[model samples]
Target: MTDRRLASVGTAAESRLPSRYLTPMDLVAMFRLPSVETVYQWRRKRTGPRAFRVGRHLRFDPVDVRAWVDAQRKEVAV
Candidate 1:
């Protein structure tokens, strides 16, 4: 199989992901909160910042997520 196929199938066998990436759980932990389901909902709604896709897996850049969180903090502070 091709490298692309391997990345799409072999690596993501566990979660049916097309690529090996962070899950909603991983992100929630990084954010120090408990809102796994909400995060997934936000992804669907497209109102919770942005994310990236690798094959069939959803991934968030740590920097982008942190930046988004910072923006939220600023809004709340205001």
Candidate 2:
């Protein structure tokens, strides 16, 4: 598939994902960061990925998180 087509597919798939889920600590740990508190700060600043609450718990869709991380990876050309 062409790059454009692939990108379109990715965009569509991502759009179907939930925008909220992971708790501040979960997010930080998933990202392998140092402090969980930083996740909260990011939420307050609205600079990190979107998140939502489910009852008293927070969660992040594994697929969405993987997709987002993959998108951020640097591609190296041969």
Winning model by TM-score: 1
Per-candidate TM-scores read 0.59, 0.47
How does candidate 1 fare on TM-score? 0.59
Candidate 2 per-residue lDDT over residues 1-60, each given as its tens digit: 699999999888777545656566767766798897776676689656666668875555
Residue 44, candidate 1: C-alpha displacement in angstroms: 1.8
Candidate 2 has a TM-score of 0.47
Looking at model 2, report the run of 10 residues with the lowest lDDT sum.
69-78
Residue-level lDDT for 32 in candidate 1? 67
lDDT of each: 0.68, 0.66
Q: Extract clashing residue pairs from model 2.
A: 20-51, 20-52, 21-52, 21-59, 22-59
Off by over 4 Å in 2: 1-23, 74-78
Q: Which ten residues in a row have the lowest lDDT in candidate 1?
A: 12-21
Instruction: Give a tens-digit lDDT track for model 1, residues 1-78.
Output: 598997887445434322334567777775665688878888899756578878887777655665577788999999
